[model samples]
Target: MRSPCASCVSPGVVKVLIEPLSNQLAKGQLDFIAECLHGQESGVMATVFKVSGEIIAKVASRLFLKPDGTVISNIEDELLVQQILVDVQQVLNQGESRVKSYILPSGIAGVFLEVIHPIVPLVVFGAGHDAIPVVNLAKHQGWHVTVVDNRPGYITFERFPNADQIIFSEPQTIQNHLDLNSRTVAIVMTHRYESDLALLRTLLPSSVSYIGILGPKSRTQRLLQDLKSEGFLPKDTQLQRLYAPVGLDIGADSPEAIALSIVAEIQAVLANRSGGMLRARFGSIHGEEITCLMSV
Candidate 1:
């Protein structure tokens, strides 16, 4: 039997008033998105119900989102769809809508749907042409980005208006300034060996998860050998963290195509995935790796 308010589940229409404002994805938002993955905040709608028998699942995700969270769908839970809408209404009823985190009522879990939200710190080592489009796409994806470049003219706010921080510095000298948590993806697009080599030596030992070197494979191998010769990888830990010749082999030639490949690689890594396609891969997309990860 179909549920009474079936129209509510019509892939339904959700309307909210709009206001013009600048967008900024904050740190708190990232943490919340991660925390939600662990079932840490009471209950969430984490599955996407594909119905063949009937379209029983309904997804409404605008409720739990705060003004900032709403901007990016940080707390997307189709299970919490109506309830979250109710939560928002409650806050709106009280004239407020921001919470560090909150629990949801058990009865509210009904919808079966997939809600996607992700957070990655885009660490760019150079502000080159390729780096520009990548940063633009990252911003469009609502990522937290920090850009470092040797040229002030390239790293200026005018050049990268949406970047959280744009710094002009010696490439090798700037690694000390990076925050290499498990969520970071550092891209070294600098064509100069001095700059690229310096970055490898500087960042190889950090806790970062992804390091992509934008160059030919032959150059990358030679550079890695050079790094070893210089005692940059005198330890096992340093060897394990290296991902030189960054990006998948998508046969990308254009700057944008290369950026696309790099971003695709980063996304795969973030999801603990490989081979570049979901259907082509084996096993579940999210599993123990999803839960036991350093951060959800």
Candidate 2:
């Protein structure tokens, strides 16, 4: 059981708690968060709070909730964690943080659920001069970026200092080097006709969320026609995820400006936006504003 006074946290006092299994050693919440990021795992951190007055609330227990319904905390009682599992999962699925009040054994408790998603994985197929700015911008956005090229001289750590991984692989052998997932976004800009064709043949059928190909519409159409002639016909749904002539229409003439447009388009795709002007839309900039949950 958690201590009743646990909720009465003082200002500037850090209240951190975690409990490992009987055989495992204990770790702090920060360490656990680091582990999650390192492993590319998604989870939620739930912090319980006690409503002290009209304007203030105090921190109580904190727990980490995994997608498999496992809870990690020092609280001896498992009932509270179990009771909030459904709500936690809902918030996690929405990919949005939320706060909800609950009627607890002690009193009305507020659980602030923070959704921790994995760092986005971006694979740049070409390590050319243009790809440099793309890699730099993605890293600035805190994405895990991988640079791939068949040219032994091109795929070097010196060339891509900020890249998390630089792979020296051709289009035929690229699949072995990549760990493609739904969260992964790929950019194709090898500048070679055969290489782009081979890469598109592989990427179009995979679960990668977005595939932005750097070329003109006619070039992309020719690649698709060639791919179809090779009997690797992609489904309509797969083609829908393809963004040929990539990047938003920002009149990007320079490499840096083009990189910005590409990065912004990727962000918009992930957020399910159409890359339109925000000033044209009404309401809050980020969809909906957070509202206080009614105390039960």
Number of the top-ranking candidate, with lDDT as the measure:
2
The positional error of residue 178 in candidate 1, measured at the CA in angstroms, is 2.7
Q: lDDT of all the models against the reference?
A: 0.57, 0.77
What is the per-residue lDDT of model 2 for residues 114-186, given as tens digits with 9 covering 90 to 100?
7777789999999899999999999999999999999998999999999999999989778898988888999
Worst 10 residues of 1 by lDDT: 287-296
At residue 160, candidate 1 shows an lDDT of 81
User: Which tens-of-lDDT digit does each residue in 1-296 have in candidate 1?
Assistant: 11111112213342222222223322443444465443212222222111222233332222234323343343344444444454544443332212212234432333222232335677888887778888887778777888898776787878788898887789666756766766577888878887888888777777776788877779988888898787765366655555656778889888888777788878776655674656775764443111110111
Number of the predicted model whose TM-score against the real structure is largest: 2
TM-score of 2: 0.80
Which residue ranges in model 2 land beyond 4 Å of their true spot?
1-26, 49-60, 74-83, 103-107, 288-296
